[model samples]
Target: MGGTNDAADGTYALRAVDPLIGELLAGLPALLLVGPRAVGKTTTAHRFARSELRLDYPPTAQAVAVDPDAVLRELDEPVLIDEWQVAPAVLGAVKRAVDQAPHPGRFLVTGSVRGDLDSPTWPGTGRLVRVNMYGLTVAELLGRAPREPFLDRVAAQGVEHLPTPLERPDLRGYVELALRSGFPEAALELPADLRERWLDSYLDQLLTRDLAMIGGQRDPDRVRRYLEALALHTAGVVEHQAVFRAADLSRATADAYDHLLRNLLVAEAVPAWHSSRLKRLVRTPKRYLIEPALVASVLRLDTNSILQDALLLGRLLDTFVMAQLRAELPLCRSRPRLFHLRQADGRREIDLIAELSGRRTVAIEVKAGAPGTGDARHLAWLRDELGDEFVGGVILHTGQLAYSLGDRLTAAPISTLWA
Candidate 1:
């Protein structure tokens, strides 16, 4: 799309991962790359812009602020606005500029949270196309190293056959992914103590800065507890009442806290996949960590701790599946809506139902380690129950090998779908 070279920005020089960057950069009028904090949104955006407009004096207040229109006029083309949600009012101005000039690649905007997650209004709508940026993928982890085994699979068979087979076990890659999480800074660094500090401060900033914007007035310590509660229960069906009970707060207060947490990008709730009126299907949705690392940080659970705690292990696996599904959807050039499935007889349940275009359904069940055929039994039951609606199934696990448990279902390592 855009003819700009990667050298347009020095930051790109250091970025080894993100195979989708070139495609994402040239997509639409305005490209909004939204992801959790420290996921390289600002770094990637600045690199895409190649240059940035620095403000000598930071504005004192967002409200009663200077007119962004006049200020943006002085900036160069293809402006990279870092932390746009910090001052979202400027986005409407950017929208107007793009509409008037009609440039394909003129502005790059990055936000940790959707500007209107609480209010439910993204200021720049038709003006910008949105893409998600997640933690470093295995491809990114390998950098320029000859294509990894998994990538070779994707290259040969295409992504459709991702679960078709598996070959080798790169334990080093698994360790790096587990230890590093998804944040770029930690992904590059190895020390646990340093990562601990980075995660602590990052969580603190989220509570103070981002949480405050969405109407959280509780004590920071208490808010931190609420986050920990959410982390412990990551990727499980949301029980607003459970959150309230844990924090010793009223229902209204707990609801407000959930909204605030989402607004800050600390968490997200995934809805159930029920297109029809199945009264037995769960109406309540599941919640997941925006980044898997937060769950580890909140639980104080590293790789070893994660393996030791059975319950925590399950949650971590679910969180990883969610992240992989979200990140890989973009690569496939498809927007996959992830949801859990449940049936009336209590006979069927699917951890993840990835509904692709033309009603193609890919069912998945996440497990802490190598999963058995029973994992896909629910999937088979679901397929039989839903008749033609249910498609093939997959059991994502911690195992090194990928193979079929039966005819309809297959098992794949969580690492296989890295980015």
Candidate 2:
């Protein structure tokens, strides 16, 4: 039960860890980095740009809104515009600027919220490129992203040579990680009480400001209830009707709220992976909170409380694993689309199915504890079903060892996600 979120000073520079995005920044004319607030998008973007306009600050946003062209012309090249969505008009200005002079490394935009759907601003569809930045992965947070390249190996070699050893945390350690969170500022010694207050305010702003900024609305109480309802279903496939029922809201309303959460990147929905022959698989997607700490906080679970609840702990651990995969996938040279799979008849389920390029697939089953071959039955079944199309399979657990489970299968420590 002892840990803190304080990150090293060097983390402020995104390039220090997230080289994938750094490399992209060099090539892309403009990069719009989107993520939930306090994940360090602004902090990282500032490290590269000569000047920044924080649109979340009212006067700065209004100045840009008054004359976006003037603001665009005045800012230096590779200008950083944090919270560009606050002034949607700036997008068109940026697009026009790009069209006039089609050069690489022109602008760096960072947004914690999106713009209104009905807003008149053009999205700069072809001219601007958008990439998401998530909370630090354990690997990036610990400064091992460059030195430890296992995820790349998983993508390229498919469990060939083994990965290096990793720290295997006990149950308490796992829960501590969840509490410490991946949010950059939160990771940096944000006190426990303040973290709670920050979450409370974050959710409030989402309902009152972020949603309205995007031409949306929801009952604050109802949305909270819906989130609580959704928390119970995290890491598993559940129907929309079920979520609506649990939240006591209309189907349309629940659907709308769900879409907003997705747009904000707070809720990550993993679609069911299927093939033409796998029509029997359930088509419903599994939705999880984008960060494990959010799941615990939404459910009001602390260390002691979570340790007492094995079932919830297991589900949260699955969310933890999937969230890490989501963050780690983009860093890979061959980025794969993440999905979840379940048989319609409920006979088997695979926690994660990553569809990589060339029709190759990487299947991962998340387990809270160390896994046995018996625990890998579903993973093996998937391997047999996919045959050669299956690049590899692994039972990712909170254990230290990374060993073969035979037939291109490996029992990998979950830490391999970022280590």
Candidate 3:
């Protein structure tokens, strides 16, 4: 129930990005942690910050709004500027500070919304290095370092090298994990009913306060309906027309809502993978609600409900797998890019693909139940198509066993994500 890497104060959980933050601090003049609100960005930044300038505080925000440079100059080195977006002028101040000294670890800024939305020209373009922060991943919840990306390891060493999982969740267990919600307060601290309320409140705040902060003025009811529609199609190649029709939104309003959701970090798109070697591949990106918990919350789905709907269960599982993979991305040495692959004819499809260095790829398929050789047929075909460019293929499933499906292919339990 408690995080393994809780800070001395017992209020913070050491995250997978903690080491990356330290590594970046040693050289970067400024570091910006960007993510959804209440995702623990402020808590994480507090760990390294010596002096604090919380722009969320009204007086502080007013001072920064009036004269950002003066407010910035008064703060000590390695200052934390929480909710810098509240007073967007601080970006120019931070930029100026970095230009004058060019010192590492001088500023640590946190923002709930995307930084670029407030300004026509971003002042921190070169001075600040942005690092994405997401909700607590299962690895972080368990207090595991996840020092190396599991997928990257599979790409490099093949599936034979996968560690035997210490814990393998059954189908029901996996469903619970998906519903656990990665938000620290929801996943770690709250009861089920309270957690549901917390999630609902989180979405409410996002639609009202957060949307207004980003200059998005729209009907909350319409936005919520749109969000619910998107939730139904989570982890699938989105059909814009169908979604808009379901939400009763016109094209222009739907696009605006889409932009707002993305800027708020509530929705994400995993782009379709395309290669010159392959033809008739679908280029539509798969849309997700950023985390499985949000999808479950938006749909008002419980464990029993999800278990009853096979299609919904599979999509949620995919979303769950994606959340874990996105968390592990920062740790990957090769810095792979994630994409979903599908052919126009629907003859071939890969749930996820990690394109490693040199355009080589590691393909993955997510299955709700134990996967057999047939489940890996698509992966094997991709392997054969790409030859040496294909590092390996894996069928991640709810099965308890890890075994070989064929050459350069294996079926491993989904728990290996955090193992």
Q: How accurate locally, in lDDT, is each candidate?
A: 0.65, 0.75, 0.85
The 10 consecutive residues of candidate 3 with the worst lDDT sum are 1-10
Q: What is the TM-score of each candidate against the true structure?
A: 0.84, 0.92, 0.96
Candidate 1 deviant stretches above 4 angstroms = 1-27, 54-64, 117-122, 144-176, 275-279, 344-346, 386-389
Cα displacement (angstroms), candidate 1, residue 381, comes to 1.6
Per-residue alpha-carbon lDDT of candidate 2 for residues 156-235, written as tens digits (9 for 90 to 100):
77874558456767767877777777776666557888876666666677666766665455576777787887888888
Model 2 C-alpha lDDT versus the unseen true structure = 0.75
Candidate number that wins on lDDT, 2 or 3: 3
lDDT by residue for model 1 (1-419), tens = 01111333343423332445556556655677777777777766766685454331266224314677766677675777766656666787877788788667677777676646434465676777777666655455555312233323333343335552343344333433655666766655537778777877777777786666556466777778788888878877756788678777778767777877776666788887886634578767788886777788877777777766777777776786576556555555334567787655556677888766556566778876677877778777666655554556778676777777775567887766642
lDDT of 3 by residue, 37-127 (tens): 7778878888888899988789999998899999888778789998888888888899898999998989999988883654557888888
Evaluation by lDDT, superior candidate among 1 and 2 = 2
**What are the runs in model 3 whose C-alpha is more than 4 Å off?**
1-11, 115-120
RMSD of each: 5.0, 3.2, 2.3
